[model samples]
Structures are given as C-alpha cells and as structure tokens.
Target: MIADDLSSKIRGGELSPGVALPPQKELSARYGVTLATLRQALQQLEDDGLLSQQPGRGTFVAEPRAAYRLDSLRGFAEDLRAQGHLVTTQILGQTVAQPPAWAAAHFGDADPAVRLERLRLLAGHPAVHQVSWIHGLELAETDLSGVSLYAALAEHGIAVHRAGEALRPGVLDQASATLLRQPLGTPAFHSERVTYGLDDRVLVADRATILGSMMEIRTEREVSGLSMQWVQLG
Candidate 1:
C-alpha cells in the first residue's frame, strides 16, 4: 500500500524528477509505518525504475527514459538524430549468409541474404545493438560503412513502404552486455521488424537489442482517436 501510494505520486508528477524523498525516519512517521516497512516500500519503487538510491545520498525520482517512435520507416540513427543527438554507427560484421530461423521465417527460402550487424551510439553512449538481413538486392558490392541499412537499400532503388515491429522484454548475454556496456543479464528490450518495399516485397528482416534504461516504446493517440503512432526512445 505504501509503495503503491508513492509510485502513484511519482507517476502523477507530484514528485518531480530529481527531487529527493524525505528522510527515512521522517517518511516512516508521516506514513504511519515502521522504518523497516518504509524501507521496503522505497526498495520496491527503486526496482520498478521510479526511484534512484545513492550511497550516503538520499533517494530521488529518476529521470524520464528516452523513447522511440515506430510510426515510420525511419532507421535507428535517423530517430536519434531527430532528437538533436549526435548519432554514430559502427558496423560490427557484414556478409552474405543463410538466414537464421527468425529471418528465414520472414524471408521464406530467400537464401544468401545480406546480413549486417551494427552497434549504434547516441551522443557517444552505447544505445542499441542491431542485426539485419536484407533481401531483394546484392549488397556485397555496396559499401555500408557510416550508412544505415535503409539508406543503402534505397541506393539500390529499393524503397521501404511499410514495416511491422514486435517488442518484448529480454536479458543481455555476455557478448551483448559487453558491447552495450551493461552487466550480464541486465534487462533489455528485444525488437524484431520486417520492412516491405514496393509491391509488398520484403526488403529487410531485422532484430535489435536496446538498453531498457535508455529507451522505451511510446504511443500517441490523438483525441479524435482515428490515428495512433508508436515511437521508441533510444
């Protein structure tokens, strides 16, 4: 009950971000709870991402997480740039290969797809690790350094018309955690997408792992309720 009350206040904007909570003893007295119970309540909020506790320092409300918009065919780099952030891309690996199970499920016997792995940074901070499998083009002769897969495909006269995405909670492995600068088993967001080009041809099958602390899924629904847009924060 105490945790829920405090969480409601935080979400309702009564306790602004960066604002420190009351001292444990005082807070416990005000809430009519024991110190132990109050501490447990605060710990619950901390685990829920609403509070931050520092050693020797008091707890404070956490800042709002970044979000990503999914209403368009925008690339990871493009989305961050729109938020006035400097974006950089590092191509980890790129080659032609057989599609993985997830990719093959969408590509449907489209062997020899161009596979590319990338680590994208926002303002020098590691943000997302992504891998993509592109079909309907020969990317072996094309250069992808410093360019997004969407842009490279566009150069080959393939225009993305529509895309579908799925997102779920995940945990980072040792390899992914090292690249994203997070501890092993850290909470993460796992996203999969399939992009379509002209005539409904599949252009790209991609998967991405995003740092949960640095990103979230946002959706806006207009008052008229006719349209809704989904965005992700990185």
Candidate 2:
C-alpha cells in the first residue's frame, strides 16, 4: 500500500525528480509505520526506478530513463527529440572514402561511400556513439549537426522503406569508453543496421553503441502484430 501511494505521487510529479524525500523517521511517523517498514517501501520505490538512495546524502527522486523504441524506424536523435528530450549531436568526423570491410559487405561493392561519425548526448550526457556509411547520399559534415540523418536523406529524395538490424550485448572498448566518458568494460548495446530506400537499394549501413545505463529498449505488441523476432547466431 505504501509503495503504491508513493509510486503514484512520483509518477504524478508530486515528488519531482532530484527532490529529496523527508527524513526516514519523519516519514515513518507520518505514515504510522515502523522505520523498518518505511525503509522497505522506499526500497520498493528505488527498485521501480522512482527514487535513488545515496550513501552520504538522503534519497532523491531519480531522473527518468530514456525509452528507446525498438519498433521505430526514426533516427536515434530524432526519436528522442520528439519525446521532448534534450538531444545534441557532435560530429566526430565526416569523410568520403572507401567503405570499411564490414560496411562494404553490406553495400555489396567497393564503391566510395561517405563515412560519418557522430556522438549523441542526451540531457548533456553521452548517450550514443554512431558511425554510418552512406552509398548514394552526399552530405557535408555540417548537414547533420542540427537535424536528423533521416531528414537529410529525405531532402535528397531518399526515403527509408525498411531496415534489417542486429543487436548484441557488449562492453565498451577504450575508444568508445573515452567517447562516452565511461570506464572501459562498461555495459552497452551494440547495433548494426542496413537500411534500404524505397527503390529497394541499400542506402546506409550503420553501427551504434548505446549506453546501457541511460537508455531502455521498449516495444509494445499485440496478439496479431508482434514487433520482435529472435535469430540464432552461430
């Protein structure tokens, strides 16, 4: 009962994010419960991601985790921005060059491709590091700084019809850890995607590493319309 009540208050914004809760003793008295019972309720809230407990500092409401939609075709920054998240993109590098072996395999050719590297921050924190190889689109490094890559592609008359993606659990490497400001071996999600245009031609091959602690993958499904499939990889 106490957990439910506090959960409601937190969700309703009565307990705003970063706001500290009252002292445990005081809260116990107000709730007419023992300190042990009160702590249990607070533990429940913390487990539900509604609160955070610091060792030296008191408990505070936790900032919400970003929900990454697994079912969306939108670009990462674009999807989060639409949810009212403060997203910023830093172009690490952009160059017209021969595609890397892995990216070349997806494009099925050795044709020159534009390689764009980007680091995305959410609420001023590093969230995603991405590199993309484009086959048909010509883009300046500045073209993607303030807009979605998909939007830029659309402006060039390319529309994404569908994409095939694979995801696997990984730990951050030295370079990725430095970019994300996390220690080496920090948990992350690694994704590879090949997107096709409306004409059924491969347009872009992308690789992205996402911070596991800051983002949550979410999807909704009904009995008739499932959004997920599992593939057994050797």
Candidate 3:
C-alpha cells in the first residue's frame, strides 16, 4: 500500500525528478509507519526506477530513462528528440581513412571511407557512443554535429531502405567508460548495424555502446508486426 501510494505520487509529478524526499524518520511519521516499513517502501520505489538513493546523500527521484525503440527507423537522437527529450551530439572525430579490418569486410578494401565518431547525451548526460563507417560519401565533421546521421545521408541523396542489427550485453571499456562518465566495467549494451540504401547498396556500418542505466530497449508487438529472437552469447 505504501509503495503504491508513493509510486502514484511520483507518476503524478508530485515528486519531480531530482527532488529529494523527506528524511526517513519524518516520512515515517507522516505516513504513520515505522522507520523499517518506510525504508522498505523506499527500496521498492528505487527498485522500480522511480527513485535514486545515494549512499551518503538523501534519496532523490530518478531522471527519466530514454527508450531505444527496436522497431524504429530513426536514429537515436532523432527518436528521443521526437519524444520531447533534450538530446545533443558531440563529434568525437571524423576522418577519411581505410575502414578498419572488421568494417573493411563489409566495405571492400578498394576505396577510402569516412569514419565518424559521435557521442550522444540525454539532458546533458552522456548516453551513447557511436562510430560509423560510411562508404562512398565524403563527409565532414561539421556536417553531422547537430543532425541525425540518417538525415545527413538523406541530404546526400541516400535513403535508408533497411538495416540488420545485432545486440548483446557488454561492459564499458576504458575508452567508452571515460566518454560516458561511468566507471570502467559498467554494464552497457553493444549494438552493430549495417544499413542499406534504396539502391540496395550498403551505405553505413555502425557500432554503438549505450549506457544501460540511462536507456531501455523497448518494442511493441502486434499479431504479425514485429518478432524477436534470443541468442546465447559465449
């Protein structure tokens, strides 16, 4: 009962994100419950992602988590922005170079490709680190700083027809951890995608590391619309 009431307050916006709740003893008194009971209720809320508890600091409401839609064709930044979230992109690097050995397998070894590295932030917190290798396009860093990669590709007459992606659980490495402001070995989601253009030619190969604490993968199912498969990783 206590958990349900507190959850309702949170969902109704009575408890806003980042707002600290009253001290435990005070809350217990207000709710006519013992301190132990109050703590239990708070724990329930925390487990549900409605609150955040810092060891030395008081508990506060958790920031809303962004959803990464499994069925969407839009880029991460574009999808979140459409849901009224503030998303910013930082270009880590961009260069014309030989695709890495892994990417080279997809894009033949004959031509130089544009390699772009980007970091996406949600409400000023780092959320995703992505690197993309694009073949046949001469792109500059400035061309993608504030726009969606798909939108940028469209500007160059490239339209994404479809993409195949694979996802797996991962832990943040030193480089990714530093960029995401998380400790090394933090849990993360790793995704690789190969996108084809309307002409049926592969256009971009992308790899991304998403902070699991800040985002959730979501998809809706219909009678015949979308399906999912689970694979075991060794």
Candidate 4:
C-alpha cells in the first residue's frame, strides 16, 4: 500500500522527478508503520525503476526509461524526435557495393546496392548504428549526404508503404563498438527490415544495431476474441 501510494503520487506529478522523499523516520511516522516496513516499501519501488536512492542523499523519483515503438513504420530518427529527444545522424561511409546474401535475395537482384553506414545519436550519445542498402540501378547518381534516407527516397517517388522487420541478438563488432563507445562483444539488438514502395516493390534493405542500454522496444496489443496489434506509443 505504501509503495502503491508513492508510485501514484510520482505518476500523478505530485512528486516530480528528482524530488527527494521524506526522511525515513518522518515517512514511517506519516504512514504509521515501523521504519523497517517503510524501508521495504521504498526498496520495492526502487526495484521497479521508479525511485533511485543515493547512499547518503536519500531517495528520489527516477526519470522514466526511454522507449522505442516496435510496431511503427516510421524511421528511428523521426520517432525519437517526436518524443522530444535530440537526434543526430553521422554518415560514416557511403559507396556502391554488393550487399549480403540475405539482402541481395530480398532486393531480387545480383547487382550492387548503394550502401550507407550511419551512426544515430540520441542526446549526444551514440544509440544505434545503421546500414542501409538502396537499389543501385534505380539511383545511380543520387546524392544521400545531409538528408534523411527516407526523404531522399521520397524525392525519387519511392515512399515506404509498409515494411517487414525482425529483431535478433547480436554482439558488437570492433568497428561498431568503437563508434558506439562500448566494449567489443557487448550485447545489442540487431534489427533487419525490408521496406516496400507503393506498388509493393522492394525499395530498401536496412540493418541496425541498437545499444541495449540506450533504448527499449515496446508493443501494445488488444486482447479480444482474437489478439490484435494496437496503435503504437511515441
């Protein structure tokens, strides 16, 4: 009951982020509980990521975790920006090259693709490493620098209508680790996506490595007679 009450206050904005909790003795007195019981309640809230306790500074409401929508067709940069987070992209490399076997099969071509390597930063920290493969034959001389990849595609009348996506566990390679400022072999989420145009034509293939610590993926669903996917949260 104590934890629930405090959690409700935090969520209701009665206790704002970074606001310290009352002293242990005073809180126990207010709740008419022993100090041990009050401590237990506080510990439970801390475990749920709602509160942070400093060794000597006391407990305070924690900032909410950053969330990424897994059920959207939007770009990562677009999504993050909508949530009021500062987003930036650094183009690492851009060239025409043969894609991996899986990407080649998805594009239904043996020809090369325009490969781009980019690092996405959230609030000045590296959050994801993206590698995109666009059809080379269709865009032989297209310049991609200083523009959103989706915007560039839109210029050529190739808007992404729908996409197929999958996520798997990955280990950070040396190059990726160096760029992301993480140790090699760190666990990450590998996302693979195939974007389609209006006519159901494959437009681009994308692979992204997202840092585990920087963001979380969430999906919502409606539980009726049959389960159905619900709208995504920004």
Alpha carbon lDDT of each predicted model? 0.83, 0.88, 0.88, 0.82
Least accurate stretch of 10 residues (summed lDDT) in model 3?
135-144
Model 3 — TM-score against the truth?
0.79
Q: Between the candidate structures 1 and 2, which one is better when assessed by TM-score?
A: 2
lDDT tens digits, residue span 13-118, model 3: 8988999988888999999999999999999999888889898899899988888888878888889998768899999899988888878777656478889999
Instruction: Give candidate 2's error at residue 106 in angstroms.
Output: 1.4
Q: Which residue pairs in candidate 2 have backbone atoms (N, alpha carbon, C) closer than 3 angstroms, thus clashing? A: none
Report the C-alpha displacement of residue 90, candidate 4, in angstroms.
0.1
Error of 4 at 161 (Å): 1.0
Q: List model 1 lDDT by residue over 68-105, tens digit each.
A: 77655688787777765578888888888888888988
Tens digit per residue, CA lDDT, model 4, 179-210: 89999999888988889988887888999999
Better of 3 and 4 by lDDT: 3
Residue 133, candidate 4: C-alpha displacement in angstroms: 0.3
Off by over 4 Å in 3: 1-18, 23-49, 52-59
- Residue 6 displacement (Å), model 1: 25
State model 2's lDDT: 0.88
TM-score of every model? 0.69, 0.82, 0.79, 0.71
